[model samples]
Target: MEKEFYIDLIYKSFSGDLSEEEQNQLENWLSESEANKKEADVLEKTWQLSANFSKDFEINLDAEFAQLQDRIDLDEKGNVQEAIVKTMPTIRKKSWWKPLSVAAAVLLLAAAVFIFNQNPATAEMLAMETLEGEMKEVALADGSKVWLNENSKLTYPDAMNGEERRVTLTGEAFFDITKNPSKPFIIDTRDAEVKVLGTSFEVRAIDDEIRTEVVVKTGRVSLGKKNDLKPIELTANQKGIYNSKTGKKLNYEVKNLNSISWQNNMLEFNDLPLEKVLEDVENHFGIKVILENQDLLKCKYGSLFPDAKEAEVLKGISSVFKMKLVESGERTYRLKGGDCQNTSE
Candidate 1:
């Protein structure tokens, strides 16, 4: 295959312009060998880098293109083969400010050369998340740590610079921020901004949900809205809730830090509705517990389940509520029964 044809296919693939035949051809070529796939990867990365190239540095295009063209020619003629591998180092050393014939040449050469040599870790920002039934631990460059809850996402820059350390959160996460008195740590949720110098806290902010919650485990945290000036400050064992639509703050204190008991693989239900309990179970265990009768959800119970198997918890619930547990599907169960008041064994 002509090398330019593959290059054109790479451009089309990145631009989402690949037709069925072109996609099939590219896939076939890629599957033929690992080298072809690596070549494709290089081309794709180059295309992306060219699209988002930082304008801070001036790139030399004419000299770079000529050097690249020479390598291509040598490869085509099967001559000067020893120089092929050395072309990358030469391209890396080329100045970015040199004059080019056209913008197209700049994009192609800069992308193909600089992108190939760039370190992926230098990217401006990184995003992380936890899938269902999984909790993840992430250490930021600034020494802060984050424990992402199941089905949660956190987006932060590779390095924390500027006047403040900022991160965006969706769903829930427990943060253990490293103390930097000059630079306060700020969390941007859907409804509120949580500011703390150095503290351990939990933020729960679900998209489209009416309320955003923050619980400070240690140190202090300030909760404020984007449009409001008076921020609600809370200390350890204190909780704050922000109404997303109404812009109201509700602050309170809890008896213990058991609100984050899930960190220890424990589920604590403090007289919560059965419906909410089942939802928490599903979120933590990655299962579906369907209430066969909606009325059954009215039953409320409080208990602590520590590292117990799903079956054991299900059996306990069945005995407590006098309900029947039936298998609906894999990792799914149906609870069938009428609502019963809290029963003592």
Candidate 2:
């Protein structure tokens, strides 16, 4: 049988277009010999790469196949150079009349790459930005959310369809990422690379500043510096600070809410009663908080609730007080069943 039959089967397999019978035939052929398996592997890689290329440019498959056999390797200008594929017999045939060897398959991929990258196009970059005194909320395609602070910029692909969801940031932003263990989220900054898999955190990497700070609100975040500094993992309320000028990394528990309140609408308290915290939340987010048990109010609370959402602030307060948060009325939450005896600050 012509090798095109097997190559067709391999390409069909990638798109899940093969029938059970075709699959069986392909499998049987693959198990026939090591050479066949290796050839199939090469064909599969070529098909995938060419498929990606085809999305950007139309594929004249027959034309590509015919020309690829004639030469290999792209010049500095991405023009195909004349290089003979020794495996191809000198007796040329018509469009796909002859079977494609593994070398030809490899050459076809190279041609597609050169042709696709011929002009050397820059990647299409998309950006979301916030000006001075402006705060913007952006929802990512991956269900991740970002609250960009003033003078901040976040540039990312139209689709974060890679092994990792990556974006570049300049200035401060709070990210609430969707959990996908298979795909980690990465934030590239001037100083470090912050990686996470489903977490809520704030990253401050201003252009004019030498300090890059990451404060984790929930879940875990990995902070890796561009320099030789060791990476650090930050958990709930943990802060990681990297000084690019000093080449120093410092991580500690989050103290006072710093540089994030602009986006969070957060209320920072040194050491205040739960009642006072809720009072500030009420004023900040235009929400009211009711305590079912009066004792819960006496429980002192002081932690950063760096989420712009009103409910989240109340939820954080209730969690600290061990109270059940209930949205009893519009713009009002009732903290049900709580005690000061088990309170934590």
Candidate 3:
């Protein structure tokens, strides 16, 4: 059968409007072929997600029929009654395709309404996405899971099957993929790709400027630019940063394979400049910092701050360098006369 015909049949089946003959035909086709089964599964899951359909999987065409009757009654009794009745003959005389089309339209509307009213948390489970500074842990339709990080979004089909499990990602996320050697998990990030059968790894693909970085905490993962089909594999405790613009891969020297520490609100920097540190503080903690002296921008320093308090962080910085830190407002701060140069090694 043609793909469109099966697609239409799947929609009709879920809508409880498929005739007995059509239902049997669909079942036979799905049973006879793997390709048909996969397509049916995807369509069924899509319908479930889009409509919030119950797991019990019973569709009442009678209820739909009742709704149609109500519409007919309202239209007939209303001011357009005569015109509608006059038009009824035309509708009734429509070809077989007409009734199916009308039924599909109504079912689509009902499905849309069901999806629109779905709870956001439930929707997230069905299709995970995160905004900037937003992090979440989601369990997928499969036993696998993901930890999404700041400014990231992920979209997967409602279900997974077949030889490859595919998902689209934007920004950053960590995956603790369950081992399924038969079906490798593939993450498409537009410019880069991360493929693995089972592994725990972090992928950071922010703006086009920053190189896409993948840090493998366990197992192994393959990373490559989207256009580059061949992937560079990273073993445990290894980090690979792919420069999107130049397509160069920078392999960072590995030390430990700890889970990403951003959640603890602690940032570990080695020999990073104070100005650069302040930039991170502003982004994660949501505050603005100003340095009065241009030279201070080059001063290197390191410290840990509770990701919660911007003021306390400034205080710590001021104390460390003997500088004066002042808060201008909730959004802005200024630093002056920090013995930053003298304090540096």
lDDT of each model, Cα atoms only?
0.64, 0.61, 0.59
Candidate 2 lands at a TM-score of: 0.43
**Could you give candidate 2's per-residue lDDT for residues 1-345 as a string of tens digits?**
777898888877787788989989889999999999999888777876886653477876654643342232112112211212432354133232222211100000001000111111233457888998788998887888888777777776666666667777776677777777798777777656777743566666654444555665555666766434568765554556555554555555443343345555656764577777676677666677788898766677766554557666677767766789888888888889866754344
Displacement of residue 24 (Cα, Å) in model 3 is: 99
Among all candidates shown, the one with the greatest TM-score? 3
The residue ranges of model 2 lying beyond 4 angstroms of the native Cα positions read: 1-123, 227-229, 268-345
Better of 1 and 3 by lDDT: 1
Candidate 2 backbone collisions, by pair: none
Residue-by-residue lDDT tens digits, candidate 1, 236-284: 4455665554556656543333446566566766567788778777766
Ranking by lDDT, best first?
1, 2, 3
Q: Write down the TM-score of every candidate.
A: 0.49, 0.43, 0.49
- Backbone clash pairs for candidate 3 read none
